[model samples]
Target: MRGKKLADLNVMERIAQEDDMGTMTKDESAQFKADRQAAQAKYGQMSAEEKAAVRKAAQQKRLSDLNTMERVGQENDMRRYMSY
Candidate 1:
């Protein structure tokens, strides 16, 4: 009987399996720190109700955009079948 062997995966799988620590380059490290500080300041100013409303609005916009594009794609596909 032959033994089964597992296949070696790519770097992406390894990265996903491990924790992130000191993985960024110098430039990325600086930018990430700046972004984090900026986000903390902005989020600190928003009330809980305002934050909830903003998240809801973002979700609604994404859903609406997805629906609109899906409709446009279906229309285009239907036209292809109906043409003489």
Candidate 2:
């Protein structure tokens, strides 16, 4: 797990990596499953335009997060150089 990227991990391995307790409580797991099913049902009822909008929004959010991460890395490098 040390050198493995998230995409390289299998589903259970990824879940293990993300969950510090290594497993969810039974109630929490049940709630999560119900939420997922609900979301799937809602999405299934959405029109194609709505689905595309959702995907576009998600893509935009990912791009925004990537930009923020890159900016933070650059700032960290600047701070390190300035301290030298």
Candidate 3:
């Protein structure tokens, strides 16, 4: 049996494999990141559904942190308004 070629992998899988390879030098990694950033910057936009999904995830994360913030703020308020 023959082994599969690296080029045969899909985009996401190829990126993952590159990540696994661990051979990319710091300069190469920087260039790859810059290229990706430039590509995203040029006429980069998300669909309504994608935007909604991101917003929903962010809202969910914020909701998870709400209780922690409320506790901290309540504690601060109690200390600020404390009577001697």
List the global CA lDDT of all models.
Answer: 0.68, 0.77, 0.67
TM-scores vs. true structure, each candidate: 0.41, 0.56, 0.31
RMSD values, in order shown? 12.4, 13.5, 15.9
Q: Give the TM-score comparing model 3 with the true structure, all chains together.
A: 0.31
2 against 3, candidate with superior TM-score: 2
Most TM-score-accurate candidate? 2
Total clashes in model 1, counting residue pairs 3 or more apart in sequence or in different chains: 0
Q: Give the TM-score of candidate 2.
A: 0.56
Off by over 4 Å in 3: 1-44, 68-84
lDDT of 1 at 53: 77
Give lDDT tens digits, candidate 2, residues 28-82.
9999999999999999999998987887777556546666668676665545433
Best by lDDT: 2
Ranking by TM-score: 2, 1, 3
- If both were scored by lDDT, which would come out higher, candidate 1 or candidate 3? 1
Q: Please write out the lDDT profile of model 1 over residues 1-84, one tens digit for every residue.
A: 024222454566655556566577999989999999999899789999888777777655654666666867666555543442
